[model samples]
Every structure is written in C-alpha cells, then in structure tokens.
Target: MTTITTNPFPVNHPLTFHRVAQPSPPTPFNSANSKHNTHPLTAYTYSTKHAEPKLSATSHEDQPLLFLLRQRKTEEAWLTYSQSTRLPGSTCLSRLVCQLSYQNTKEGFTRAQTIIQRLRDERQLHRLDANSLGLLAVSAVKAGHTLYATSIIKSMLRSGYLPHVKAWSAVVSRLAASGDDGPTEALRLFNSVIRRVRRVADPAIAADARPDTAAYNAVLNACANLGNTGKFLQLFDEMPEFDVKPDVLTYNIMIKLCARADRKDLLVFVLDRILDEGIDPCMTTFHSLLAAYVGFGDLETAEKMVQAMREGRRDLCRILKDSNWENSENADEVFVKLLPRSKISSDHDPPLLPKEYAPDSRIYTTLMKGYMKEGRVSDVVQMLEAMRHQRDSTSHPDHVTYTTVVSTLVKAGSMDRARQVLAEMARVGVPANRITYNILLKGYCQQLQLEKAKELVREMADDASIEPDVVSYNILIDGCILIDDSAGALAYFNEMRTRGIAPSKVSYTTLMKAFALTGQPKLAHKVFDEMLKDPRVKVDLVAWNMLVEGYSRLGLVEEAKKIIQNMKENDFYPDVATYGSLANGIALARKPGEALLLWNEVKERCGQKKVEDSSSSAPPLKPDEGLLDTLADICVRAAFFKKALEIVACMEENGIPPNKTKFTKIYVEMHSRMFTSKHASKARQDRRMERKRAAEAFKFWLGLPNSYYGSEWRLEPDDGDDYSTDSF
Candidate 1:
C-alpha cells in the first residue's frame, strides 16, 4: 500500500475537498496509520476528484458599483450605494452623475439634481473634479437643461474650479438661441466666466478654461442677436487679444449684425474682410447676405446678388459698389471702421469670393422671398420651376422653397393655386409642415372663408397627420371674427386648450379682437383680464389696442380713455392704431371737446413738423391718415372750423392731403347758411365774427367761393331774439 503523505488535490481547485478518513478500527488502521505517520500522520486529506460546493468569487460588499454602471444598471447601482455604509470612490460617483445627466429625460435630470443636492449636503461635491463637472455640465445642456448647466458651471467657478471651454460654450450657444432676454443673459454669463478664467493662477487650468474660437463665436452671436453693434465690435476686437482668429462663422455672424443694424453698405465690406483674412465663406454667408437685401426691400440688389452667384461671378464687392444702395452713405461709422479697406473703389477690382458659389435651394428660396415681397408672383413661380429643373440636387426645391411658393400664392389671394401647391407637395413627397398649413389657414381667414379654413384645419390633422397648433387656432379665431362669429372664436379657443395646446399671445389677442369686433366691450374686457392672468401670454400693444377698440366702437369714450391711461401705465404708449380707435369712438360719442384735446396730444407727439421738415428725422409719432381724417370729420360736423383747419394743416404737413371734396360736401350740406344772418347785435357779431373768419379761411383753402357773395340768398326773421339776426 502506498501512503501519500502530502494532499493530492491543489488547495485553490474548485472541486477540491478536505475530509478526515474515518478510522475504521484501531487494529484495522494500524498499518496504514503507521505508514502515514512517517510523514507526520495527517489529520485531514484533500481531493479534487470529489464533488464539493462552489465558493462565491466575491462578497456583496466587494462588488464594484462601476460594474453595474457599465451594464447600464444605473438605478441598481445607485440603490446599492445608498444601502452601503461606505461611500463609493470619486470616479464611480462622477460616472454616476454623468450617466444620469446624459439620460436626457426629465426624470433623469431631476434625479441628477437630487444626486448633486445629496453631494452638496454631504460636503462631498469636491469629490467631482473639474473635468467631471464639465462633462456633467455639457451633458445637462444636451439634455435641454441649459439653465441647470449654467448653474453647474457657476458653482464650479464659485468653488475656484474652471470648466472646460466646451461646457461654457454649449451653455452660451443655447442661451443665445433663446428668445426674450436670453441673449443678454448669455452675454452676462460669458463675461463672468471669461473674467474668472483670466484671473486663474495655474497656466494649465487657464489654458483649458480659456475661451476658444467657438466660445468667442457664441458670445459674439449673442451680441449680434441683441443688435448691440457696439458690444459686437468690442467683443470682436477682443478676439485678437485672446489669440483667437476669426473664422468664416465669425464673418457670418458679423453679416447678420450688419443686417440687423440696417447697415447694408457694411455687408460687402464684411465679405471683403472675410476674403482679406484668408477665410473661406460658407453657405450661410451667402444666405444671410441675400436675406439682408430682401429685408431692406431692395429686391433689385438681392436679385443682382443671386445672378452673380449663378453666373459664377465672384465680383460681388465690385457689383455692389457700382450699384446704388439707398443706405450706403448712411452706414454706421463704427461698423465701417471695423471692415477691411475696400479694394473696389474703382470699378475694376478683383473678385472677393475665392470660389464660384452655386445657388442652392436656400439661396433660391431667399430670392423667391424677395420676389414674393415685391408682389412678383410670376417671377416666384418661374423661379420655382427653375429650381425643379436643376440637375444638382442641392439646387432643387425643398419644403421651404415650396412653402415660399405657397406663401406667395396666398398673399396674392390665389387660394386655389395655393391649395394646388399643397397637392404638388404631396405628389413630390415633400411633406408640408405646420407652417405651410398655417399660411393657408391665415389666407383663408383673411379672406373670410371660414368654412374653407375649418375644412383645411381638419385636413391638416386627418390627412397630413399634422395637428393644428396654437397658430392654427389663432387663425381660426380671427376668421371667426371676420364672419362676425364671436361664439365660434370662443369655442375654438376653448378647444385649443382642451387639446392641451397652450394658448399663445396671438391666441389671446385674437380672441380679444373677436369680442372687440362684435361690440361686446365687457366681454372683451373679460378676455383681456384672462389674458393678463395667463402666464404663458403677455398683453402686448395689439391686445391693448383691441381692448380700446372694443370700448371705442360702442361710443364708450370715457372707458376708452381709461384704457389708454392703463396702457400708458403699462409702458405702452398710444400708437396710431390706439389713437385711431379712440378717434372713431370720439366721433361716435360726438365729443368735439375730446377731439380737440386728442388733436393737441397728437400734434405734440408728431412734433407738428411739415412734410418738408420730415427729411431731417423721423417723427416720434408718425401721423396716420385714418386717424387724421376721423379727427377732421368730427371738427367739421361740430362746426369747429378753426380746429378743422388746424387738423387739415397737420395732415398736409404729414404729406396726407386733406379730403377737400369731403369737406366741401360737408360745408354745402351742414354749414352753407352759417353767419349769413343780418341785424345781429355788436357783441353777438363780434362773437360770431371769429368763427366766420375761420370758416371763410377753410373755404378758401378748399378752393370754394366766399359764402358772403357767392350766391343769392333769401332771409327770414330769426326766432331767438338774443342775437336778433335774420336766418337764411
């Protein structure tokens, strides 16, 4: 018998087992024990051949949280950390934060916020290093929590931690894209962050946090959007200080700024500057240039620019220089200084564009919009056809191009053609978005085609699968007003809310307009009140004017005056529309005294300038023909000839000719026999003479013969003895 002294099985083998051989009997095991005793008689022997229970690889406490995170088991990982007594490592926590933020869901963001709050409470926020904080911030921005991302970066800055350029740039870009005061906030945030970076002691951290080209572009874009030309120039100049060279996008943003500032002369110079800087222009540069020209109502210039692109002529600077741009001489001095020196002073100059730019769908669409603006419907249609025939797919008409065609047709009162275009869109497989449908709906509403508008709305939902948004309901409400159906307007407004679509400012204002048009002033007031209560909508000037119109239409002059007072209190001055409505109200109420007062205020607001003097500066209040006419009508009806003459003079000064024919007709019908009585007392004659002189002057201005000797008159005795005058 061989006695194996050492254990035959490996200690760490899975199947290894240890057991003591049962001592059968002292006499039976004597020889075996004696043989094993030579190697120091073993108390136990191990064997791998026998089956044994498997041991766990690791304990629960030893499990890695990051492993769960890698499996995307975020919730489980978090739960495990919460249940454990020891906190996870900093790397694990940072990964958890980043993963939660990247989920991009509302719940995900909320949970991320909760995690941050827990860290702050535990004084463990420092565990998340600067790099991890930056990732979290960028992730938050991607998840649509821009403000939250901004807060995160701000917290980092406050804690003497500098964020990466990507983190702050993303936030700035998002803020610049928002409406209202978002651009201003973006500028403020950029200034603060940049200040912090400049003050950093460590060169490495400063370099990482320093605003790069993208960061500068973002803040410059914000400045452009705000129309702060001075701020834009300041920031643009600062780019060189930061050692950041301006790219093509920087010039693109500069073009937009010039457009907003109405400095068309600077546009070409900007292109020249781009070329001088050795930067290639992008497609957006061309589109922005065309759009700028179109916005200025300079379709001639816009068309020329597009033609230059089509003909592969890059001498845009030379072309624009030779052409007569209206606002060229009036360019802002500061802006002009920033542009590169113009080389196209003489007609012969090199092309600014380095390469031939082919007109794409967007470029074509921009030119089409210019044609649409000028009411060149045929040109717009021809352009659309031209786009369809283009071999290059980039130049082919897309949905926006088609939508422009539809808008042009609608504006031309060609609803039939517009609807046909919609069909063509479907046939061509270019799906019409809500904007296209809304344009059609607005056209129908403007034409008072309520039934057609309603049908179109249903078609949008049932066929196009495009739900009618708030704009659709707003259009429907205005259409209802056109058909004198205030109840219909209210129903549509309610339906919009019931469908969970929030009411926009247009919706509220439009519904208020419905009530105002139907002579329901009180109901209009209620609508206005509801609008004030709606946080989603702000009461704009149009809404206030509608309220004023509601009251004034019913001859509620006092109430209208009160509303105007409220309008002033709300920082909304009385515009021409407001005064026009009030004037109509005054006419209805027959309050000539109020007319005189309103004229005084209007004259002051208009600066009482003559048409010849209007070239110097724009009047604070541009005179409206309708408002002046309404005021003049009131004065003539009340036989206030002096006040009527004043209003007519103001009209002529504003270049709105007085309605001499209407005034002549009024005089013949109402005041032909005025002051023709004889035998009046001295005092009474003196009192009547002033009005008589004013009437004669007005008749003279109207090119009418003097009433004193123009025609034969029969006199009768006056009934009232106070004046003792004969009536004619």
Candidate 2:
C-alpha cells in the first residue's frame, strides 16, 4: 500500500484542533506466529498464493506497522483503565461509549475515548478493522465531527486492518462538504486513497465488493462541484486503473460540471459517453441540460430539447411498461407500473405510496411542469385527467400546482387552457392562489380586456384578501398603456406603491416600455429613478435596448443618449444590440456625434476582431445618407416635414445621396406628423401616411423605419445559420 501522510484534524475551522504530537503507535500483533493466529481462517486475506499466510505487500503486511498506521489515541484509553482502578468494559462497550461521547461533544475527543475504556468490560467488542471502520466512518462523517471520524477510521486499521476505499471515501466526502474549509486537502486525500486501493490487490473480494470504483465515483461527484474540470476529466480517464466501472451518477456529475463551466463541447461529449457507458441518465441529468440551454436563451436548442423530451417520454413509458410486464414472482423486486398491486384493486383505504407517485398531487404536478416547458397544452389536460382518474392515496391536490399550470398557460397565450386549469383547480376544492388570479388578470390585459383586469386586481385585495405581487400590478399597468389609458397605468403604479409591494425590475421595465411607446420620457425617467433605490434591479442590456428603441421611436436622441450614460454608469457595458439601438436612435434624433460615440464604444468593448461591421452605423461619419434615408422614411410616415428637411440637409452636408423612397416617404410623412391641425398634431398624420402604397414595400424587408420591432433583429445575417452545429 502507498505510504499514508495527511493529518485529518481540521485546523482551519476556528474551534477545531491542531495536533501537537505524533499519534501513538498501534498495538503489536504477531500475524506470522502460528499460536497468535486467533481469527477465523475464513477472515479476508490479501493473498491466496501460499497455503499459509504469505504477507501480502498490499492488503495486509507486518501487523505492527498496519496497527501503527491505523492507530489514533488508544494510549490515553489504555492508561485511563489503569488510573481509574475500575474494570474497563468489554471492547464493544468501549466503542459504544466512544460513539456516544463523540456524538455529544467533539471538543473532548480524548475524554470520550477514556470513557469508552472505562465502560469496555460489558460490551466485549472485537478488534475493529477496515469493513467496520468504513461503516463507522460513514456515521461519524454524517455527524460533522471530522477528527473523531478520522480517528475511528484509523482505529479499525490499527487493530491490524487496512482501510478499504469505503472508509477513505467517507472521510473525503465529509471533508469536502464542510465548505468553510478548503477542498484541496480532501482531494489530495482522495488521490492517496485511490492509489492505496489500487496498490492493494484483492484476490476476489475486490471483484464482487467493488470498493475502489464506488469510492472513486463518490469522490468524482465531490470533485465536480469545485469547477476543476481539467482535473475531473483527467480523473475520468484514470478511473479504469482500479477496474472500476463508471455508473450513471459519474456521467451525471460530469455533465452538470461541464454545464456550469459553460463547456458545451464537453457537456455533449459526456452525454454521448453516458450512452456509451450503457447507463440511463436520470431526470436530474436532463434538468441540467434543459437549464443550460435555457440560460443563454438558446431558443432553438431549448425547443429541440423539449421536443426530444416529448418524444422520449413515449419511449420511457414503453420501457416502464415493459419492465413491469417482465417482472415475475421470482424477481428480486416486483417492478409494478410505478404502483403496487394492492393500490390497483383496493376497495378499502390502502397504504400511500411515495409523494412522487401519489395520485392527484405531486406526481401530476411534476408532469404538468414538463408539459408547460414543452408547450403541451394537450398533454397538460391529459395529466390533469390522469390525476382526477386516480384516487388520491392521502392528501388532496394543493393550490401550488393548480396555480402553476394556470400561470404557464396564460403566459403561452392559451387563455382557454389557463381558464380550464383554474376551473379544474376549483373543482378539486383546491384554493385559488394570488398567482392564479394574477395570471388570468394578465391574460385579460393581453387580450385588451383592461376593465376585467382592473376588476380582478381589486377583487384580489377586497374580496379574496390575497395580496398581489409586483407581477399582478405590472400586467394591469401594461394593459392600460396598450389601450391608450395612461391615466389607468399611472393609477395602478400608485396603487402598487400604496400596497407596500416593492416594484421589481420587471415592473420598472414594463412601465418604461409603456412610457417610451407613448413618448413620455419624463415619466419613464421618474420610474427609473425610483427603481434605483432597490439594488436588486440592475440596468441590464434589455433595459438599455428598451430605452434605445423607445427614444428612437419618438425621435428623442438626447433622451436615448442620457439612458446610455446611465446604463454605463450602472456598469452595464454595450452589446451588439446597444450599438444597433444607438445607431437607430441617433439616426432618428439627427445626432451623428452621439451615435458615433456609441458605435466606437461598442467596437472597443466587443473588440473589432470579433464583432463584424453592422450596416446600421457608418464609421467616421455617424449619420450618413442611409441614416437620413431611414429618418426620411420615419418623417414621411410621421408627417414631420421639418425633421425630414433637417435629416436631408445633414446628409447633403455629409456628401451622401438621399434615396428616392426615403425622400418621397419623408415628404408625405411631413403631411402626417401635423395631420390634425397645421400645428404639430403628429399622430393622425403619421397613421394616414403609414397606409401609403410605396412606403409599404421599403419598410417590409427591414423592420420599421424607426424602432426595432423584434429582439435581435439584424441588418446582417447571423453566423449560427447551421442548426447542426448545436444539435450534435
């Protein structure tokens, strides 16, 4: 076996100890002497090479050294027996005392062992060894006393037993999990254990027992949490040395670690490895994959994964059914179709199964969540039907699951399905949550049913006494703004404050979008300033994008510029969208210098090497003929002649040609931004011009003449055109 060295005492945890002396030597045992061989001949041996015990360099060696290596503080225990003048109990009693003492007070580890010796005579315990040491270690580690845990582990080995990978694993796992301390030492301990387990070759027990591989797997899981992917990968390759088989847990751990590290290549690689290893990955494995795809909003991949899950669920159902059908009386465990036979035919009340399989509650709830992710309204109804069909073994369906399905359907634009989910929840006598009411209210708002949304909001507090969260208020305010009811939006906003529910980032974002859409910069800025009091809300890229799009739509370039400064001050740097917003907003506002500064900063942050040139902005000169062309298009539609003329002159001075569609569009739009009266009655004028013949064709290919209509709308094509790059 490899020479052991590391001390187990946790010096880092403030109350933990520091050893001042070398641990006492192990009790001497003459393993080679014929008369001294007191153990059953059937006791596990290191080698079967010789008829008599021929010292195995690995599992067993000279008894004194093995004893010494495993020894903890037995010298104190041995002395306490002599000093007390009372009979020390049997070895069994001694160990029981040690266990109880360690469990109660870890600060007195030496005293605990002394009590064990004083009580030893009654228990009559045998000498401890590897197998027992590993089991005791599992308990000790669980209790969070590392020193006592390590001592007992070594104590077993001191009685002429070498620790197997199990004890080593127990100690390593405990040390790693006690996170206030570092992981490096625990990892080092694991490596030494692996080497020691390897060097000690078992004749047959190693094959059936599988101490090395199982221990290695547990350590791998611990290692995966540390973000040390390189070391983890290396360990993966080295796992075969001890003939340990890789299991599903091993692959799952590696897959999750890769996802956390953002190593997509390795994640897919390990996924394939899971298939090759012939281990079926669990839901947890798929959850990690699903979350990873969703994190960056990789919509295509997320959709594909959802599709795969839907298809695979059918296969899983077939497999589960097949497994159940295959089970016979001779089978070690009866694998029913996830339900026991008694439950199927029970006229009387039956024993309830686990929460996961219990009808009408947790199980159906989980299935509903899966359906919502896949946008499977049909499947959701089927699962709810299944829940209703099955008699609930114990508790009834709770409101949490009922409302979750409702909210999901509402968000997916399936108002009928949302109402159906809510109705089923009510039929089951499940209480409606604030979430359920909020979801339906938001849905009504989305459908432009503002009065109904307002009525529900009032009912929530007055009739139901359910306090609404920020989402409930935001949705109503948004709906009000959508229907040109700014007064309603403002009233809802005030009510949100009065209710003592702090507005979230979503609340601020929704209000800002409403203001930007209505060209109310001052109101939007007021809400944004209020949001600053809450640190939870950060000015993210989407927030800046909204401002850019909003200001651009209204031709308020100065307002957009101020928003950019605020975004940067909050430490939110510009992305590709930031540049697009600036370029579009500045062109509308007729500010080339401001747009140029934004474009330059975008280049610097993204590095010109990575980001390709976007056609939205021109280098050196900010607002070019193309920009004027865009502005003129907006002007012609809005019927703002003065803004159109200003744009044309700006392009002309910059030596750029004003395009035909843009100029004609702008001239027509000048008639619109002032349609109601000869004054700046812009709304009616722009609406009439927008319906014109020639203006329609030019704006179709690009977004609107002003604001970006879609998220990530680009003038240039994206490089991720090949869907295959992500799938494999």
TM-score (all chains, Cα) for each model: 0.75, 0.42
Per-residue C-alpha lDDT of model 2 across residues 609-701, encoded as one tens digit per residue:
345774333233244444445545555444343344555555566577767564544433332222123332467456545433233333332
Which of the numbered candidates is closest to the native, going by highest lDDT? 1
Q: Rate the local accuracy (lDDT) of all candidates.
A: 0.76, 0.52
Cα lDDT for residue 132, model 2? 29
- Total backbone clashes of candidate 2, pairs 3 or more residues apart or in separate chains: 21
List the candidate 1 regions with Cα displacement exceeding 4 Å: 1-101, 105-212, 215-228, 297-304, 311-316, 319-331, 608-619, 676-681, 687-689, 705-728
Q: Tens digit of lDDT per residue, candidate 1, span 1-728? A: 11111221112321211212221111111233332332111111123464533432434453578688767787787777778777665556666766666565656566666666666556566555454556666766776656667776666655555566777788888889877667998999899888876665554435656688999999989988989988998898888767898899988998888888867767777877887788888899889888988988888888888899889998887787666434445456667667745423444354578889989999999989988988999999999999999989999999999999999999999999999999999999999999999999999999988888889988998999999988889889988888899999999999998998878888888888888988898998998898888654557889999999999999999999999999887878888999999999999887888998999888877874544445423247897899999999988878888889999998998899888999889877777666756656788789888787888887778777765557543234354333212211
Least accurate 10 contiguous residues by lDDT in model 1: 20-29
Report the lDDT of model 1 for residue 567. Answer: 86
**Lowest lDDT 10-mer window, candidate 2?**
14-23
Residue-pair clashes per prediction, in order, are 0, 21
What TM value does model 2 have? Answer: 0.42
